[model samples]
Target: MRATTEEDATARAAVVARGCSSPIRTATGVWVRCGSRIKSKCESCAELYRNDWAAIARSGVFDGPVTEFRFYLLTLTAPSFGRVHRVPRDGGQRVGACSCGVEHSATDAGLRGVPIDGDMYDYAGQVAWNRDAGLLWDRTRRRMRDRWDSLEYFIVREWQDRGVLHVHAIIRVARFEAPTPGVLRDAALSATAVSQVDAGVLVEWGEQARCDAFRADGDGAKTIWYLSKALNYVLKDVATASVDAPIDVWRHQVALGDAARRMRCARDCQPQDCMNLVHKRYGSRSQVVSASRRTRNRTGWSFTGLTRTVQRRLRREWWESRMRDEAGDDAPALSPPPLEDLAARSRRELIARGWSAP
Candidate 1:
């Protein structure tokens, strides 16, 4: 509100409808949402983003009608250059200790994507792999056509336990040829043979490449939920890391951040570049969940069409249900005001007469 004493008017006052200069207050007090995908940067927004992705995954945009189509989960990993800190699932049954001498805890975030020996770790190879990962997947998709007439796939890339990027994809085929796991794996490996990393060299998927079909008889929602869970894990794992960790521990983390900065062209990349796609979708200031063009494009599996509004509503419903489950149905619902209403308006727009006294 503003007031002034003018020669023509004895004390004119104006009530300006403008956003509060200060942050908005809620039941929890004044809160500012950073809207970051990284949980450490902003927990609320990251959770929201994660929920949005889960909603999209379960929405069947790529996976299709659960009852009508059978889905396959395929993981194509990058080849390893050397030993790295790997938190053994069986408590060091696989490998006694990472050559780094540190027995990484099962839950240690720092240990997952770091090289045990940084000096010997192939940073050049790692960068090359990241750059061409999309191409590799393109080949794999082309080859998979031989097995199924129609296919829908959603692929996400994440830095593996060894700091190399790997893809986790959900493939849906209508006919259900039901190829053995080895068949799909062999096809993916064969696709890698076509990759021309160097004139004389070929890039290959890591030995850990896996191709497994979802249980034929499982509930539709459950199967989709499981894929969504894999997606959520990838999103969370790619979130920003603590800088205090050792160089090897956080090396790939740094590379990922750098790649995101450099790779801005969506058309240049496939579904593998999650970080870059994310940055392009939402600018640096705002980070929301997003899927890749590869998933949405006609090249992959298609789903029964749903209206945009319906899709959004379904996502919202899923989020609400998740919230209810976690906090109970009686929990307080905090619905923020629409952004347009809350945002500040221009002075001319706020003024009733379309003009203000000089």
Candidate 2:
């Protein structure tokens, strides 16, 4: 990565990792530089990416540009009227791996399934909700701005396809130089105007997905924090019967005998332009793709996905349960499932309930 100017060089120098001279060595910290730039480079890690050429990124440099991030993660649960065995987010223990073999402590991860899933949830609605969750949340951002007037800045909206169903967003609220503070806090954000705006948007999405999206049926603007924070938009693979319900063993057996399906059929489902989608979502049209796909880099699938996935796991395992605890029997705060508005909802509900759309 070429340093465009001297300031870039100085900024890059700040986070550069250094090495200690110990025969029994730990890996070296990495930074991109030249002879006069910064001599700090880990030869061991340099071997990991000899062809690497991407600038390291840091935050808090921009003046008056405060960012609010919303990560959309799937909340798993049992499908309606179906046998319940969705992958437990933490398998119902204080400290253990998820059904997917992810391991962590309850003090660290929280009670299993308390955050993402619980027994007796409407799973079908969640899946249907996932299909176009972006549009749903986008509407909320607009409505929120209109109602509150304080949030009238910019929104970074996107989704994550890795997990069951989820979204991610970066809300940029412009700061006034006079008296504005940092990111808006919960208590400060819970004004009547804001709550009413949330209610309208929430009801609209719930009605579209054709299921009550919230744990509590009505009056839940205070709990829609989930939709507000989803900028990365990765859908976590859920273990809920409702959303990721068990496949029918009999149906699978019959399909195996009837035909030989190409494994590529599964490949057909995955998108070729995930990085491109990320690029589109972030409005970074000409983002440098100079590094090879195989290289272990920040933008690659493994590194970014791993950090995001672990975060989802940690969030499901930690934050959700705590919020539920704080909310008590009252339903905990969560992302409002993203969905189409009344126009789209009318078409689908017509079909689901055996009616017609005019």
Highest-scoring model, lDDT:
1
Any runs in candidate 2 off by more than 4 Å, and if so which? 1-123, 148-163, 175-358
Candidate with best TM-score: 1
Residue-by-residue lDDT tens digits, candidate 1, 13-79: 1111122222222222222222344555445555555665565555554344556566677787878
**Candidate 2 lDDT tens digits, 236-271:** 111222433224422322232222111111223332
- Model 1: how far residue 210 lies from native, Å: 1.3
What would you estimate as the lDDT of candidate 1? 0.52
For candidate 2, give the lDDT.
Answer: 0.26
TM-score of 2: 0.26
Q: Candidate 1, TM-score vs. the true structure? A: 0.58
